[model samples]
Target: MNIGLFFVPFFEVMRMLFAYTTEKQLVNARNATTGTQYYCPDCGSLLIRKAGSLLIPHFAHSAKEICHGMSEGETIEHLNLKQMFYQWGQQTDQQWQLETPLNDLAQRPDLLNRKLAVEIQCSSLKSTRLAERIKGYSQNGYQDWWLLGVKLRPNKKFTSLQKQFCSFSKDKGVHVWGIKKDEISLFYHIYQQDQHYQYSKKIWPSYSVPITTILNTNLSELPPKIILSKQSVLAEKRRLAKRLSCSEPKVMKVQTYLYLQRRHLLYLSEWIYFPSRYSFFYQEDLLIFRLLFQQEAKNADTIFKKFLYYRETMQRKWIFHRIEEREILERLYLEAIFCQRKAKIL
Candidate 1:
C-alpha cells in the first residue's frame, strides 16, 4: 500500500470523524439544555431549529435579523474590523467607542474615534442612501469618516459612488473620507475559511488604503523592528562568522548591537525587514505566526517563545545560528519573525 496516500485519507477520515463527534456532542449538549430553547447567544433572537444531516444544532430566525443571520464565514470579518479599529485606536492614542450613537439621525457607527466615524457595512444598502449617510457625517462635525463595506461581489456602481463620495468629501472640509470594500468571496477563498481577517488584511490596500503607501511603508520602514533583537543581533553576528568560515563576526557589535539597544531601534528594524517578506511564499506562514502572538507579549521574552518552532526550521539558516540557544535569543528571534509577519499580513 502507498503509505502516504493511506495517511492522507486517514487524516481526512480522522478530520471528518472528529467533526462528526464534535457535532454529536454539540447536539447532545443543546438537547440537554437547562434553560431557554429558542434563544441564540449571538444576537439575542428566537431561533428556529434547522434540521440537516450534519448533526450539529443549527438555528435560524423566522425573519432575518441584523447580526443574527450572518453566516459563520462573516463572523470573522466583522470581528476583524472591530479588532483593527481597536488596535488603530490604541496605536494612534485615540479612543474607539463601539456601537455609539451618532447625531440625531440615530446612525450608530460600529466604531467611532474622535476624528473619524467607522462603519462596518456588511450588508448592502441603497446606493443613494449610502452616499447620503456618509455625506451626513461630513455635514456633521466628523472630519474623517471611513465606511468599510464588507460585501460579496460588490456592485461596480457602488464602487464608483464610493469614489465620488471621496471626491465630494475632499471638496468639503473633511480631511479624509473613503469606502473600503472587503470582498467576502476573497476572504473565503484566500484564507481557506479561517475566521480572522487575513484576506482583508492582505488586500487591505484595495479597500482601506492606497497600495503605494503600503508598499512604501513596507520597503522603507518595516524591518529592524521585526528581526534583530538585542540577543538576536549577537546571534546573527555569530551565525555570520560560521557562514564566512572566520573566527570573527563579519558584522561588528557597533553595527548590530549598539543601535539595537536604542529606544526606537525596533522602528528602524521594521524598515529593514519589511521588504523581504512581501513575497507570496513567506506571507501566509508569517501571517499565521502573527495571529498567534498578537496582544500576548508585554516584554520581549513572552513574544519570542510564541513562534519558536519556526526558528528551529533549517530554512531560516540565512538569519540565525543553531536555533537552540539561550532562551532569551530564541525569544528575540520569535518576536522579530512576528513583526516581519505582521507588517506583511496587516
Candidate 2:
C-alpha cells in the first residue's frame, strides 16, 4: 500500500552480509569470528566474512556461486538499508527475515514478514521483470512493497519505470516512500499539471517510527479538487496557439482533427483544455477525449460508454495496477460535470 526510498553509496566490490549457519542460525559478518564458517541461507554455500575500513562488515560467497540470497556486486547502501530494517524490526519486536528466499514464489525478497514481501531496489530493473515479480507476489497471496533507491527517485516528470513503482491508497491517493539516512519520507497526493506532477511529502525518523504506524497512518483528507480558472485556461490556449503557429507535428495532428470536426484549437469549448489530476494515467490525448465527449454531448450514459471503450481498447494505460477502474471513471465523470457547470457560467 506504500512505497519507500533510500540513499547510500554504491560499493563496486559487494556481496551479502547477512547469512545463516548450517543449523539456520542468523549471523552478521561484522560479529562473526574470523575463519569461522557461515553459509548462504538460500544456497547453503560457504560464505567469506568481509570487513574493511571502506566496506560495511558483511558476508560474501567464497567463489562466484549462483544463489538468490546473494546479489552479485551488491551495493553497500543496499546492505546498510537491509541491516537498518532488520534491526528496526528486532527493536520493534516484529519477526522479520532478512534476504529470505521464498521457495514457493521462486524469489528472494530483501525482507519478509507474514504475507508482506519487501523489495529494496537500489539498481535499475526492467519494466517486464518488475511486472513479473509483482504478479508473482499477487498470485501467491503476498503483498509486494517496493522501496526506491536514490537513483530511481521520482521527479516533477516521471519516467515509465518510476510510474510503474507507484502504489495507490484512499488516504494518500497515489503515493511513494523514500528513505535517506535515518529519515523515511512519504510522498502523496500525486497529481499532474500539463506535463509534470505535483505532490506533498511527510518525513519521519526511520528507526524511531513504528513500521505499522507509518504503514497505517491516514490523512483522511480528500484529494485536491481540480480547479481550472479562466486565466489558467487562457495560458494553455496561448501556449497551444504558439505551438500551432510553429507547425509542431503532435499539435498539428490535434489541430487537423479539430478542423475535420469544424473546430479550431484555440476557439473550441474551454472544457476540452481542462487538465485532470489523473491525467498521468492516460496515454491517449486528454484533449482529444474531451473533444469526442463534447461531440456526443447528450447524456451521461453515452459518455460513460465511450469512456469504457477507451479503457477496454487500452487508449489509456493505468500505471498503478492497484487502482480500480470505477474510481478513475467516477472521478473523471465528476470532473467533466464540474467543467460543464463552469462553462455554462462563462
Candidate 3:
C-alpha cells in the first residue's frame, strides 16, 4: 500500500527548504558515527529526506510532524533567484544571512541583512498573504521588500492583477519588482497626479550597485501635484475633457454624469467623480474643490453639513478603500463655492 506518506504537505510556493550537507557529512550520517538531523531553517523542526536526484534534492517534514502552516514548494524560479540573490548578497559589505530565522517574527526571509528582509515570489501571492508578510516584517522592525520572478512581455504593460501584487502603503506608494533574465527590474511610482509616471529600473545588483541606486529615480518632469492644487485639477480636467468630447458612447459616461448632476460642464469645480486611485490609482480630482475656497477658506477647516451626504452618495461607487468623510465633505463644499464663482464669472 504505497499511499505515499498519508497526509498532504500544506505549505506551497516557498523559496528555502533543504537538507544541505556536504558529501562527507552525508557519509558520516550514513555510518551512524555522527548523529545528524536535517531541519527546517524557519521552524527548526526535523526533516526527512527522499534524497536522490542531486538536481532537486529536498527535505520533507517527518511523519505527522506539524509544519505549523509553513510548508513550501520551492520552484525552479525560486531556486535560481535565491541563488542570484545569494551571489549579490555575498558581495555586499554588510553581514548577510540566507533563510535566516527571525525569532520574534516567525519569518524566515529568503535573504536577511541587519535591517531588511528580501522575499522572493515566483508564484501568485494573495493580498492577505502579502499584507501578513508586510505586517510581520514591520512589527519586528525590518524593512521588507518583495521581489517577483515574473516579468511583462516586451512592449506589454502590467495587468491589474500584477499591479495589485504591489500593495500600497503611505510612504512606499505603488510599486512592483522583478528579476528579468538575470537583471533586476523594478516598476515603482505607479500612481501620479495625471496618468501614472510609471518609472522603471534595470539593474544587476552588484557590490558597487546598491539597491538604492535602482530604487530611486528622477521624477522632476511630472508636475508638482498637490491633491487639490488648481493647476493639477486643470490638467486632469483637460485630460477628462478629451474623453467626454470623444464620439465613443462608451466613454461618454462622465459627460452624462455631469448632465445628470446638472453641474456646469465647462468649469472643473462642477465635476466630482469617484476618486481615481480607487479605480486605477489615478490622482484624486481635488483641485477644483481647493480653488473654490476663498483663498483664506482654502486653509481653514469648514463644516459642510449640507453637501456631505450628497457628495458621499455621488462618489460612492466601486470604492473598496477608506473614505475620509470629513475631508470629502470639506472638498465638496469648496467644489460648490467654485461652481458659484464660475457662474459669477459667466
Candidate 4:
C-alpha cells in the first residue's frame, strides 16, 4: 500500500512511501532495496530510502528542493487521517490511490477513486486558491470532496473561507465534511434561523461507514429538517430594534438606505426577516436584499427574474461552488413569498 508522504523529524523533510528508480519504474519504499537509488516521482531527484524498526519505510529527498506539487507542509493530524483512509480502502478492497496527480488539472488530490477526488484540508487556505482548485477539478471532469481538518471545523459560524468548501444537495441541503479524531462528522441540514446559522450533525466511526455510502447518501436517509421557531425570530427582531436604538454603525447604514427608499427600518416587509440557509451566502445584506425584492417584484411570477437582475446589477459575490446562483435565489424568493403570506394570515 502506498502511504504517499508524511512529515518526518529527521532533517525536517517529507518522506514519501512511493518513488521511482533509474528504470523509471515506480517503487514502494517498503519493497525498494536501501542500496538501490530511488528518485522522487514529482521532482525526479535522487531520494534516500529510510527504513528501520523505529521508522516506517519511506524515501526522503536527497536535496533541499521540496516537491512543488504538495502543500508547504502537512500537519500530523492531516497525514494520520490520510493514512487511515488508505488503511480503510485496503480493508474494503477498494481501488484507492493516494496523492494522485491530475496532470491535466495540475492538481493533486489527497485521494482518488475513479472520478472522485478527495481533498483533506487541515489548515486555513486562501479562498481564491480554494475556488481555483475546485474549478480546475470540475472543468477536468472530477468531483471534488473536501474534508475539513480539526482546526477548520465550524463552531458558531463558518468563516468565509470555510463556506467555500460547502456543497449543496437536495437531501443534505448545504453540507460539509469534517474529521473529528477517528470519526467523520457530516454537518448537514445547515440553515439560517435568524441572525445565526444552525446545522444538524451526524457522526460515524471512520471505518464503520463505507466512503461510497457516505458520498451517495440520498433523500431516503435524509436528516430531519431544522425548524426555525417563532421565538428565535422574535428575539432576532428585538436585537435589530436594540441595535437601531443604539445607532450601531452597521445597523444605522441599513436604516439610512431604507430611509432613502422611504421605508421605515422598523416596519419593513416580513419577508425581509425570513430565515434561509442558502441566502446566508449572499454578499449583499440579507434584509436589505429582501426589502428590495419586496418593493420591486410585482408578484411571485416575476420574483426570480427580478432577483437575477439584482444579482447582475449589484454584482453580488458568489461563494458557494456547487450550488447554482439561480437555485439559491429562487428558493429564497419562494421562501420569502411564503413568509409574507404567513405574516398576512397572522
Candidate 5:
C-alpha cells in the first residue's frame, strides 16, 4: 500500500473529524450560558467563553495553535439571522417567507419564502464560484436575492466591502448588504445580476457575502448611453488617419454619415451628409436618426458639401504613417457634422 495514499485519507479523516467536532462545539456553545465550560474542538484545549451578545454566544481560543478556534459560529450566526428575519417578516406582514434546505443545484436559494431567495455568504470563495451558486439559485426559480457581506472588521471598512460586492452582481440579479460588527447597511441600486465594473488597483482580499434583500424592480428600465460625442468620434478618426499617414482623398460618403448618426452623434449628424452610395451603413445610421429626429432631410446636396468641408478641415493637420495612410485618410474624409436644429417641444 502506498503511504502517500494513506496520508491523503488520513488527512481527509482529520478534516472531517475537525469539522464534526467544531460543529458540535458550536452547538454546545450556542446553548451554553456565560459561566458554562467549553473546550477547543480541534486541539482539545480549554475555550474562553465571551458571553452571549445581541448576535449569539461568542467564544475564543485559549491555545495559540492555528486550528484551535471555532469559526463555524459564523455559519450559525447566518442561520440565526435568517430565522430572525423570516420570523420578523411574518410578524410585520412583509411579503417574505423562509424555505428550508435551499436547493442550489435546483438553482434554489438558501431561503426562499416569497419571490426572492436570500443567501448569506461570508467566505473567501472565488467570484466565479459565488456567481455559479447565485446563478443556480436564480435558475431554480428565484429571480432576486439579497447578498449580505460580513467583513472581518465592523466599521466603515466593512461598508466599503459591501460596495465591492456590487461587482459580483453583474448578470446575477442579486443585491448586497454590508454587516460589520452589528450594523447593517443595504445598497438599493445595486442589482443582484448587474454587470461588474473593475478597478486597476487591488485593494482588498476576495470574499463572498450573501444577499439579504431582493427588491421588486426590473433592470431593463435603466438608462443606456455611452458618454461619447461627435467631436470625440471625429477626433478618433483623425488621430487614426494621422498615425497611418495615408493621403487618400477624404470622401463624405453615406456609410460614414450613418455611422455617426447611429452612434447618436447629433451634433455631427447635423453638419454632415453622406452620399447615397453606401446604402447599407446609411440604412443602419438612419435608424438612429429616425428614433432621434422626427423630420427627414429635405436638402441632401448642401448638407453633403458642408460635411465635405468639415472633413477636410479636421484632417488638415493630421499626418498619417505609411501603414495607416490609406485607412486614416479615408476615415478623415468621412466627416461628423454638427447641425443647428431646434429641439422639438414636447
Candidate 6:
C-alpha cells in the first residue's frame, strides 16, 4: 500500500459482518474459529476484543499494522460522533447508510443518503486526501459535506487551504460546519471579498427530530455577510503584525522601503495589516503598494496601470507565473477600493 494511502484518513471506519448479522446468528456460530468472530474487513486478519472504560468496545487488529479499508484508529470521540450520525440517520423520515463504501472509487463516506454525504473530519488533513475525496464524490455523483470538530485537537482556528477548497451546494451555498460542544454551527453563503473568505456561522443545536432538521436546513434567515466581531479582527491583525515583525531581514527591507517612501514602519494603516489570505508576504511589494495606494487613493486607473507598467520592468523577478494570479487579484482589489475612494472624493 502507498504510505500515502495509510496516511489518507477514512471518512469513517469500515463495515463489519456484524452489521448484516443478527445476535441470534452470531450466537449459533462457534467462537472457536478465526472466522467465527470479528476480522479485519480489508486484510481478513483475526481481530482482538478490546473493551475498556476509556474506549468504546470495538475489535482491533491482533498485530500493529495498516489495513486498506480500516481506520487508522477510532478514538472515543470518533466512535461517539459516528454513533451520533448513525443514530441521527435512523430517523423514520429518511433512508440513510453509514460507512457505505463506494467500490468504484475505493472510498467510504461517513454518512450517505439521497441528497447528501458527510465527512466527520476531526483532524488536520492533507490536500491529497481532500482532493481525492472531492474528485471521487464528484465523479460518482455524490455531494460531499464536511463537519469539522471544534472539540477536536486544540487550537484550530480557520484553515486557509481548506477554505480554498471546501464543498459547495446549490441550496445551501458554500458552507463550513463546526461542532462546538453539543451545538453545531454552519458557516454558509461564503464568498471571498477583498481576498479573505467570509461566511455566516449560524448555530443549530442538536434536536430530537429527524436529521433533516439540520440536513435540509433553511439558511435564508442568516445574514448575507459574515461580520467578524471588531475584537476578532483587531486581535487577528495584531497577531499577524507580531508574526511579521519577527523576521529581521524582511523587517529591515520593509523598513528601508518605508524610509524611502517617508512612511512610518510602525504606523501603517490597520487595513494594511490584514493578509491576502493568512499571509501578506512579499514585504517590499506590500510596502510599495501601500505607499502607492495612500498617494493615489483618489486616482485608481492611473495608479493601477502604472503598477502594471512597473511589474513588467522593475519587478520582473516577482512576476513568476506561479504567483501572478494572486498578485493580479490583489491589484484588482486595490483598484476597486481606489475607485471607491475616488467616487467618495468626487
Q: How many residue pairs clash in each candidate?
A: 16, 6, 1, 0, 36, 0
Task: State the local distance difference test value for candidate 2.
Answer: 0.72
Q: In model 2, which regions exceed 4 Å deviation?
A: 1-14, 20-48, 61-73, 245-264, 296-318, 321-326
Ranking 5 against 6 by lDDT, winner: 6
Candidate 6 per-residue lDDT over residues 25-121, each given as its tens digit: 2211112233445545456565555445664455555444566655434545655576566666686645776655555667766677764777777
Give TM per candidate: 0.29, 0.80, 0.56, 0.81, 0.33, 0.56
Q: CA shift at 308, candidate 3, in angstroms?
A: 12
As a whole number from 0 to 100, the lDDT of residue 36 in candidate 3 is: 61
Model 3 segments more than 4 A misplaced:
1-35, 42-45, 48-57, 61-73, 151-161, 164-174, 189-198, 205-346
With candidate 3 superimposed using the best TM-score fit, by how many Å does residue 101's alpha carbon deviate from the native?
Answer: 1.1
Which of 3 and 4 is ahead in lDDT?
4
Best by TM-score: 4
lDDT of 2 by residue, 1-346 (tens): 2222221223233477677776777876777876677887767888778778877788876444656534435677878888887787677756887777686987778888888888777777666677778889999999888877777777667777777888877789888877655866788899887556888888888788676567678997777777777876887788788888999876776677668778888887887677677776663256766665676774566776775675555434555655566677666667677777787786
Arrange candidates by lDDT, descending. 2, 4, 6, 3, 5, 1
Question: lDDT per model, in order?
Answer: 0.36, 0.72, 0.50, 0.71, 0.37, 0.52
Give lDDT tens digits, candidate 5, residues 84-139.
Answer: 55454465455554433343443324356655666555544444544555556556
Q: How much does candidate 4 score in TM-score? A: 0.81
lDDT of 3 at 78: 74
Best by lDDT: 2
Candidate 3 local distance difference test against the native: 0.50
Query: Against the true structure, what is every candidate's RMSD?
Result: 22.4, 6.2, 8.4, 5.2, 16.8, 9.3
Pick by lDDT: 1 or 2, better one: 2
- Model 5 misplaced regions, further than 4 Å: 1-51, 58-84, 93-99, 103-110, 150-214, 217-226, 234-346
Clashing residue pairs for model 3: 11-71
Cα lDDT over the full model 4: 0.71
